[model samples]
Target: MNLLLIAALIITSIAVLAYIGSMVLQSWLYSVPADKMPLRSFVTALLAGGFLTLWCWIDTKNPGRYDTLFSFSSYDTEDFDVVDAVKKVGEEEKTIRYTRRSVGTKMVYMNDQNQPFRKADAEGAIFALIVTEKDKPVRFITKLDKNGNFPPGEIQYREEGGKRYIDDTMIGRVNRPGTLKVIYVLLLNFGHFLIWTLSLWLVMNYALGHAISIACCLWLVITLLIMPVLFTKTRKQEKVITPQVSFPSVNDPNLSEPEPKDEEKKGTRQFQDSNGNGIAILWIGSAISNS
Candidate 1:
C-alpha cells in the first residue's frame, strides 16, 4: 500500500477508536451527553471500549506473533492465518483461494503471509477465503443481523474412513444502504475504536524506536484532515424520508407522526441517509489492509 493510504488508515482508525467511541460510551454508560462530557471521560471510555475488543483480539490467539518476544503469549497458527509474512516467492501475482483436503480439514491455507490451513476443529465444510494481489471491490459481512442475532449458517458433520469431518458455509446476509441491519452494524462499528486504540499503543511502542514510522501514525493530525469532510457529508445526509418530524411543544400530544414514503411503508426499504458517524473511513482502511 502507498504511504498516503496507510496514513489515511491510521487517521481513520484513531477517530473511530477514540473520539467517536468515547462520545457514545460516555453518553450511554455514563449518561452524559457528548457536548457536556469532560476530556477524562473520553480517555476512560476509550479504555473501557477496548475491553471487549481486546477480548475479541485475544480470542484470535495471535497465531502470527509467535516469532516475537510475545510468542509465549501467542498460540500456534496455521500458514494461511499468518499476517506479517509476505508471499513474494511465487510467480503468481494473481489472487488465490487456498484450502486443505486433509482427513478433517477442507479447503484452507491461502499461501500468503503465514495464513495457515484451517482445520475442522469440529464439523467443517468448504471453508472459503478469497484473496488476491489485485485490488478489487468487496463487501462487508455483518456478523450480526438486524436484531443483533447471529446470522444463519450451514454446518454438516460426517465420518470419512473413521475420521470425523465437518463442513460449513455462510448463509448470505446483506446489509445494504438504508437497511436496519446496516444501521445496526454502523452503530456497532464504534466499538472497533477500542481495538484500534490497543493496536495504536502496540504500534507506537515499536515505532518509538524508529523515527520515520512515527510520522505515519499521528492520529490527531489525520483527524484534523478528516473532520471537515465528515462535517459536510453529515449535513448532506441528514435528510429524512418522511416529512420532517415536528415534535409539538410539551403542551401538544405526540402521536404517530406521519406515514413514510410508499417504499418505506411497503416494508421493502427505508430511508437512511449515509448514517455516517465518521467511521466509514475504517471500512475503507480495513478493505485496503486486507487487499
Candidate 2:
C-alpha cells in the first residue's frame, strides 16, 4: 500500500511538473506584445492556481492523509472512551485496560511495570497478542505512513528469545517529517498568493480590455504628479527673467542715450500709420532710445 501511494504521488508530481513546463515553453515560444502579455501570463498562472486549489482541497478532504499522518490524534477524543477491565484465565489472572493513545493503527497498553505494549488489529476485532520490549532495544516491525500514520491490520514481530509472533494492529501511526510539513505549508501559501494575483489579472484582462495599457498610462501620470511632491529636490527650477536697467554713472564722460535704428524708426512709423495703438511702438522706441 505504501509503495502504491508513493508511486501515485510521484506520478502526480511528475505530471504536474511536466504540464507546467509545457506551459512555460509555450509562453516563451509565443511571446506577445506587452499589451497582450498579461492575459497570456494570467492564463498560465491560472493553471497553477487551479492546481493549488485542488491540492489544498485534497489536503483538507483527507485530513491528515497528505500533509500529515493519521493516528489516535486524528480522531476526536470526545467520540470514544477508554475502559479498564480484568480478565482471569483458568490458572492465571491479568488486568487489561484500553488505552486512549495510539501509534498509527496499533493500540498502546501499559504493562504492570508501566512498560508500553502495542497491539495490532488482526482483522475486524481487537486481539490479545501484544508486542513489547522490556529489556532490549526498540525495533519497528512495520513502516510508518508518509505523513506518519500507522498501517492497519496485523504486524509480524520476533521475540527477544528468537520466538516469532503475529499481532493484530489497532491504531494508525503518523511519522511525517517536520521538514516536509513545513515545505508543504509554505507551498500552499505561495500557491494561494499566486492564484490570487493571477486571478485578478485575468479578471481585469477580460473586464477591461487593454487594462495593461490603461494601467501604464495611469502609472505614468501618477509618477509625474507624485515625483515632485515626494522629492522636492527634483522640482523644476523656474528661470528668473530679471529686467536689465541701465543708469548713467555720474563719473562717466558719455551720458547720452543711443539713437534708434532705421528698423525701429520704420516700425514706429508703421505702427503710427496703421491707426492701431502705439503702445508697442512706444515700448520699442523707448528701448531703442535707451540703448
Candidate 3:
C-alpha cells in the first residue's frame, strides 16, 4: 500500500478506537443509560470520521503544507560562525545570542550571501523555500559550543563509510526544532479538528431530526447525553406518576347538596321574561308570591 494511505488508515483506526474507548469509559463511570449508548457511539464515530476526512482532503489538495507550517530548518556545524551570527531586520542587524526568548519562536533564514535574516525578509525567504525552491533541500550551518562540541538546538551531519547520516537526536531536532514548535503544531491540528467536528455534528443533528428514525432518535439522545455527562451531573430519572382522579357519583351526598340561592330584596323581585331577559319588579310580599 502507498505510505500516505497506510498512514491515513492507521490514524483513522486509532481515532475510532479512542472514540469507542472514551464512550465505553463514560458509560461505565457515569452509568449512561443503555438506550443512549448506540447514539453516543454513532456521534463519536461521525465526528472522528468527519475530521479525518477533512484532514485527508486538505492533505491531498496541498501535499506538504501541513508539515511545512510547523517545520524548522536544520544546520551543520561548519557553515556559519555562531558567535558572530546576527539577525537582520530591514537594514538593521541584531546579534544572535542565547536569551530568554522561547525556542523556535525566532524565524531564521539565510540569504544568498550566507547571512542570517529575520522578520519580513526572513518570511519572504521562507515563502520562496516553500514555493519556488521547493525542489532543493534547505539546511543551515550549526552553532558550536565553547569546547567546540555539538550543542543543543543544533543538528549535526556526519559521514560514515561512504554515506552521510544524521545523529538520532539531531534528526529529532531537525524534525521538531523545539518544544514550542511541537506544541504549536498540536494546537493547530486540534483547532482544525474541533471546528470540523462541531460543524459536522450540527449538520448531522439537523438532518437526523427531520428524518426521525430509531438511529436518528438514538443519535439525538446521545447528543443530549454528552453535555450533561461531561459538564454536569446525570439527572436522576423520575418515575412517571399517574395522578389518581376520582369522580363523584350522582347518589353521593356531595352531589346532592343544593346550591344556595341569592337573598331576595325587601321590595323588589328579580324576574326573567319568556325571552330570558331579566328585570327587577317592584312588588309587595303577597304580590311577589302570586306572580
Candidate 1, 256-275: lDDT as tens digits: 46767887765543223233
Cα lDDT, model 3, residue 56? 43
lDDT of each: 0.35, 0.41, 0.38
Q: What lDDT tens digits, residue by residue, belong to model 3 across residues 1-291?
A: 243453455346545654465456446644552344445445645554454444444444433333222232222221211222233344564443311122376433444454543322431211111111235443333333544344556354433221233332322122223455445446545554444345334432323322233234333443344322321221233578999999888888877757545554422344324223322333355587998
lDDT of 2 by residue, 1-291 (tens): 132343344345434543454345435644522344444544544454345335535544544333321111222211112323223333353445544455588556544445454432222212222223354332224343543335665454322343333233332221222455555645654554444344334632322333334334433442345322322322234688999999879878686667899999999889777755567678889999999
Q: Candidate 3: where are CA atoms >4 Å away? A: 1-23, 68-188, 192-291
Candidate 1 error regions (>4 Å): 33-291
Q: Which ten residues in a row have the lowest lDDT in candidate 3?
A: 123-132
Q: Show model 2 residue runs off by greater than 4 Å.
A: 1-37, 66-95, 101-108, 111-113, 118-291
Note the residue pairs that clash in candidate 3: 75-140, 76-142
How displaced is residue 2 in candidate 3, in Å?
Answer: 8.4
TM-score of the candidate numbered 3? 0.25
Q: Count backbone overlaps in model 1.
A: 20
